[model samples]
Target: MKSGDKVLETAGILVPKVCILGVTITLINKTTEYS
Candidate 1:
Protein backbone atom coordinates (compact mmCIF):
# COMPACT_ATOMS: atom_id res chain seq x y z
CA MET A 1 0.00 0.00 0.00
CA LYS A 2 2.81 2.39 0.82
CA SER A 3 4.55 1.66 -2.42
CA GLY A 4 1.36 2.27 -4.36
CA ASP A 5 0.89 5.59 -2.59
CA LYS A 6 4.43 6.60 -3.44
CA VAL A 7 3.95 5.72 -7.08
CA LEU A 8 0.74 7.72 -7.19
CA GLU A 9 2.42 10.73 -5.64
CA THR A 10 5.31 10.54 -8.04
CA ALA A 11 3.01 10.30 -11.01
CA GLY A 12 0.92 13.23 -9.77
CA ILE A 13 4.00 15.41 -9.54
CA LEU A 14 5.45 14.26 -12.82
CA VAL A 15 2.22 14.62 -14.78
CA PRO A 16 1.79 18.24 -13.77
CA LYS A 17 5.37 19.05 -14.50
CA VAL A 18 5.03 17.53 -17.92
CA CYS A 19 1.79 19.41 -18.54
CA ILE A 20 3.31 22.72 -17.49
CA LEU A 21 6.31 22.10 -19.67
CA GLY A 22 4.12 21.24 -22.60
CA VAL A 23 2.08 24.39 -22.10
CA THR A 24 5.20 26.49 -21.89
CA ILE A 25 6.55 25.00 -25.06
CA THR A 26 3.24 25.52 -26.83
CA LEU A 27 3.11 29.17 -25.81
CA ILE A 28 6.65 29.71 -26.98
CA ASN A 29 5.91 28.09 -30.26
CA LYS A 30 2.85 30.28 -30.79
CA THR A 31 4.75 33.42 -29.87
CA THR A 32 7.53 32.59 -32.29
CA GLU A 33 5.08 31.67 -34.99
CA TYR A 34 3.35 35.01 -34.70
CA SER A 35 6.59 36.93 -34.48
Candidate 2:
Protein backbone atom coordinates (compact mmCIF):
# COMPACT_ATOMS: atom_id res chain seq x y z
CA MET A 1 0.00 0.00 0.00
CA LYS A 2 2.76 2.41 0.82
CA SER A 3 4.58 1.68 -2.44
CA GLY A 4 1.42 2.11 -4.44
CA ASP A 5 0.73 5.43 -2.77
CA LYS A 6 4.25 6.60 -3.55
CA VAL A 7 3.83 5.69 -7.17
CA LEU A 8 0.60 7.58 -7.34
CA GLU A 9 2.18 10.60 -5.72
CA THR A 10 5.01 10.57 -8.18
CA ALA A 11 2.66 10.21 -11.07
CA GLY A 12 0.53 13.08 -9.80
CA ILE A 13 3.53 15.34 -9.75
CA LEU A 14 4.78 14.25 -13.14
CA VAL A 15 1.51 14.19 -14.99
CA PRO A 16 1.06 17.95 -14.85
CA LYS A 17 4.59 18.53 -16.06
CA VAL A 18 4.05 16.09 -18.88
CA CYS A 19 0.77 17.78 -19.77
CA ILE A 20 2.37 21.21 -19.77
CA LEU A 21 5.25 20.00 -21.89
CA GLY A 22 2.84 18.43 -24.35
CA VAL A 23 0.84 21.62 -24.52
CA THR A 24 3.96 23.69 -25.08
CA ILE A 25 5.14 21.46 -27.86
CA THR A 26 1.74 21.59 -29.50
CA LEU A 27 1.61 25.37 -29.31
CA ILE A 28 5.07 25.69 -30.77
CA ASN A 29 4.13 23.43 -33.60
CA LYS A 30 1.03 25.47 -34.36
CA THR A 31 2.89 28.75 -34.24
CA THR A 32 5.58 27.47 -36.57
CA GLU A 33 3.00 26.05 -38.90
CA TYR A 34 1.25 29.41 -39.19
CA SER A 35 4.43 31.42 -39.54
Candidate 3:
Protein backbone atom coordinates (compact mmCIF):
# COMPACT_ATOMS: atom_id res chain seq x y z
CA MET A 1 0.00 0.00 0.00
CA LYS A 2 2.78 2.42 0.85
CA SER A 3 4.59 1.69 -2.39
CA GLY A 4 1.45 2.22 -4.41
CA ASP A 5 0.80 5.48 -2.67
CA LYS A 6 4.34 6.60 -3.37
CA VAL A 7 3.97 5.78 -7.04
CA LEU A 8 0.75 7.74 -7.22
CA GLU A 9 2.38 10.72 -5.60
CA THR A 10 5.27 10.65 -8.00
CA ALA A 11 2.93 10.38 -10.93
CA GLY A 12 0.85 13.28 -9.67
CA ILE A 13 3.95 15.46 -9.66
CA LEU A 14 5.24 14.26 -13.01
CA VAL A 15 1.96 14.33 -14.93
CA PRO A 16 1.57 18.09 -14.89
CA LYS A 17 5.18 18.63 -15.87
CA VAL A 18 4.80 16.20 -18.72
CA CYS A 19 1.56 17.86 -19.82
CA ILE A 20 3.11 21.29 -19.75
CA LEU A 21 6.10 20.12 -21.70
CA GLY A 22 3.83 18.60 -24.32
CA VAL A 23 1.80 21.79 -24.58
CA THR A 24 4.94 23.89 -24.92
CA ILE A 25 6.24 21.72 -27.66
CA THR A 26 2.95 21.88 -29.49
CA LEU A 27 2.81 25.64 -29.22
CA ILE A 28 6.32 25.94 -30.50
CA ASN A 29 5.46 23.79 -33.45
CA LYS A 30 2.40 25.83 -34.22
CA THR A 31 4.34 29.03 -34.04
CA THR A 32 6.93 27.66 -36.36
CA GLU A 33 4.28 26.55 -38.78
CA TYR A 34 2.59 29.95 -38.80
CA SER A 35 5.85 31.89 -39.15
**For each candidate, what TM-score against the reference?**
0.84, 0.91, 0.92
Task: Name the TM-score of candidate 1.
Answer: 0.84
Measured on C-alpha atoms, candidate 3 has an lDDT of 0.99
lDDT of 3 by residue, 1-35 (tens): 69999999999999999999999999999999999
Error of 1 at 7 (Å): 0.5
Instruction: Give per-residue CA lDDT, model 1, range 1-35, as digits (tens).
Output: 69999999999999999999999999999999999
Worst 10 residues of 2 by lDDT: 1-10
- Index of the highest-TM-score prediction: 3
Runs off by more than 4 Å, candidate 2:
none
- lDDT per residue, candidate 2, 1-35, as tens digits? 69999999999999999999999999999999999
Model 1, runs deviating above 4 Å? none
lDDT per prediction? Answer: 0.98, 0.99, 0.99
Error of 2 at 24 (Å): 0.3
- Give the lDDT of residue 35 in candidate 3: 100
- Superposed Cα deviation of residue 10, candidate 3 (Å): 0.2
Clashes of 3: 0
Q: What is the lDDT of residue 22 in candidate 3?
A: 100
Residue 16's lDDT in candidate 1: 96
